[model samples]
Target: MLIDEMLHLFYPRVCTGCHSLLAPKERGICPECIASFDAFSDADAAGYAVKEVFRRNYPASNQPESAWTLYRFHKNDRLQRVVHAMKYEGVHRLGNVFGTLLAEMIAGSTAAAAFSCIVPVPLNRLKVVERTYNQSEVIARAVAGVLRKDVCTDLVVCKNHTRPQAGLSLRERHSNVKDAFTPSGNVVPENILLVDDVLTTGSTATAVMRALESAGARQISLATVVLAA
Candidate 1:
């Protein structure tokens, strides 16, 4: 405890969202910033967004279970900065903080206890070799820990390394990611939760879902730290 106090004295903990010093009881985030972030409340998620996602993916038939996101991705804001920090700067603990908040939302949802396994969006081999870690996997581990579930880190692997998705259109992103992911083997849990850091056009998650379904997954639910606009 004394060492922790001394560390804080030397390097005070700052809120990931607001970049402000946090109080003793507070963690990497402050209470005010937590209250400021918009999450998927019952009313917000009451719409057919999840169902619509399924329908869009499966125009003729039923899709998978509903998807849930933790926060609405505001444009070029503080939350964006925090996400960038975690993804690019190796601030892995930030992923845990984001995952903890998202886990709360997941616990209150219908698919709370339905997922048989959690799988994160896999980083490509070259990128993984460069970054030394996948941020989505870190978040997935944190989420599974909170939910008392198991994580399947080896279920999905990025089969191909492609150009960066920066400034790419939705269609371009889809084309770039074609055949990008493959399951490691023939076995997959009946109900799986595919986790990622953000969701923009649902292209990436949808692609991953298709791959999982091809691998014999019965149901899949999408979860992410942020939902992009």
Candidate 2:
């Protein structure tokens, strides 16, 4: 504890969202910035937006039993800043923090106690080299810690590099991610939760889901930190 305090004195913790110095109790983020996030409750408009994305994009036959996201991701907004920091600014621990919180939500939802394993949407080899880590895997591991489930990093692999899904039309996004992922090896679980940083058009998640299904996964659900609004 003394060493932590000493480190804080030299390099104080800062909120990923607002870049404000954090108090002692705060770790990666300050309370004010955390409170400012537009959380997605089941009744909220943004929550429904996520469902719409799945409805429009995910195949009916392969639809997940449940899905949940923590925040509404608006461009240039507080959530966007938080995501940017986690993805590009090397605030990697933010993924674990958000994932732990997401696990709490999942524990209370219809999807509670359903997953046997957590599978993060994998990054292609090139992107992994650039990012140095798959942000989704970081989140998935934290979630697994809370849920007591194993994180299957090798089950699904993103073999093909694709263009970024951002700024693309729904059709283009689908085309970009199609056949980009493949399931490898054995050890398929009966139920698994797919983890990702955000849900946009659902194209990427859908592709991942299809690969899991093809690999003999019987039940698959999804959890993410933000749903694009």
Candidate 3:
């Protein structure tokens, strides 16, 4: 703790959301910024926005058992800043912090216990090399830590690199990710939870889900930090 305090004196940890110096107890995001996020209410948990995204993009047969996202995302909001830091600023551990928070949100819910393992939406090899880490995998590891579940990273993978989905129309985004992923190994669990950073149009997640299903994954659900609104 003394060493940590000494480091803080020289380079204080700042809140990712607001860019303010974080209090000692805070991690990644300060309590005020966390509270200010547009979190999903209890009333919406049963019918989460991620569920709707899947329903609109994929058939009922392809949809997950359920899906949940932590916050509603807007282009220029504080939540976006947090996301930017996680994805681009090399704050890789922020993914784990958010995942732990996500686990707390669903601690006693039936959905949390339904999955046998966690599988992050994999990044293509090139992107992984470029970024030096897969943000989703970090998040999945953290979720597994909280839930005491295994994180399976070898089953599903992105075989082809695709263009960034940002600024594309939903249809174009779907086209971009189609057939971009493939399942490689033979020992895939029947029940798995797919973790990712954000849900925009649901196209990428849908594509990953299909790949997993084709490789003998019987049941798959999704959990993400934010849903684009």
- Candidate 2, residues 167-228, lDDT tens digits: the string is 99999998999899988876788789999998888899889988889889998888888888
* lDDT value, residue 74 of candidate 1: 78
Against the true structure, whose lDDT is highest? Answer: 3
| Comparison by TM-score, 1 against 2, better one | 2
lDDT value, residue 41 of candidate 2 = 53
Between prediction 2 and prediction 3, the one with superior TM-score is: 3
Cα deviation at 99, candidate 1, in Å, is 0.9
Ten-residue stretch with the least lDDT total in model 2? 40-49
Q: List the residue pairs that clash in candidate 2.
A: none
Model 1 stretches astray by more than 4 angstroms:
43-62
Candidate 2, residue 63: lDDT: 70
Against the correct fold, how does model 3 do in TM-score? 0.94
Predictions in order: lDDT: 0.77, 0.82, 0.83
Prediction-by-prediction clash tally: 0, 0, 0
